[model samples]
Target: MESKSKNAPAKLHLRSGDTVKVISGNAKGETGVVKKILVDKLRATVEGVNMITKHVKPNAQNPQGSIEKLEGSIHISNLQVVDPKTGEPTRTGRKLNDKGKLQRFAKKSGNFI
Candidate 1:
């Protein structure tokens, strides 16, 4: 039997700086920019969504230990990229442009994303 861990990383359609909406969980319906992608884990961190608090240890950057609030990662499946033209969440697809270069486009708006 094949182990799940041996499976290849998930391919995500979303990219950094792309605006997205949370499709599920506590932050559902919230929109934010895709901050980072963890391909191996199939997760992405969205700004201002999934806020988490962490205890911090002081270092050169700060003399006092403090609590830090930061964005937490959400599964890639839970995010839907927002269509720039329509201002709505939409599916993404890749296709060749007139120059034959591959480009990502919004399936809903039928426009380049």
Candidate 2:
């Protein structure tokens, strides 16, 4: 029953496998590869960032109940893609490449991300 913002883009500029840095929060300054994007919640799970523990009940896969540590989702606003060329966090921008295809680039280094 909730509606998304009309000004928000349908898709996030980030994708899986992209290296990103946490801009704010307890995990600030930590950089890691993006593991997954949760478009519905505008959150992304970065490797080794925002880790949390979960209690799991006994299941077929694991006969005994266990505690598991896993990466938790961080708000998209708290993440910035790391510029491959500059090795720094940078804002993302879109541009047309030689093939006239829209590609994401790092604003800081002006290089394709």
Candidate 3:
């Protein structure tokens, strides 16, 4: 299914461990920290988001392999940054401060994401 979002989230600005919300897909409203970024696909896998289970065969580590829960990719467009201060979804932007250091800030709370 295709996501219906007002704006596509910028991919380069996001990183692992960043908190995000699923804004316009089947998983809308679900929030989680980014676990990995699939830049080639313009998608990301967020912890606890778009989870899927896969059955596995026996292995040396697990003798009897079992089903494992794993995260699936979600299009970057469906994700929105979660404000660290307000704990609400927000947009991210970069700005140069007086110190000449470029930093990312949350548009909604005006705080660092």
Please say which candidate is ahead in TM-score: 1 or 2: 2
List the lowest-lDDT window of 10 residues for candidate 2.
1-10
Candidate 1 lDDT trough over 10 residues, lowest sum: 3-12
Total residue pair clashes for candidate 1: 0
lDDT, candidate 1, 4-104, per-residue tens: 54677555798899999999999999999999998777799999999999999998888798999999999989999999998999999999999999999
Better of 2 and 3 by TM-score: 2
- Reference-based lDDT, residue 66, model 1: 96
The TM-scores, one per candidate, come to 0.87, 0.88, 0.80
User: How does residue 85 of candidate 3 score in lDDT?
Assistant: 94
Error of 3 at 8 (Å): 19
Off by over 4 Å in 1: 1-9, 58-63
lDDT of 3 at 87: 90
The TM-score measured for candidate 3 stands at: 0.80
lDDT of 2 at 70: 99
lDDT of 3 at 64: 79
Q: After superposition on all CA atoms, how large is the RMSD of candidate 1?
A: 2.2
What lDDT does each candidate get?
Answer: 0.91, 0.90, 0.86
Model 3 lDDT vs. the true structure?
0.86
Clashing pairs in 3: none
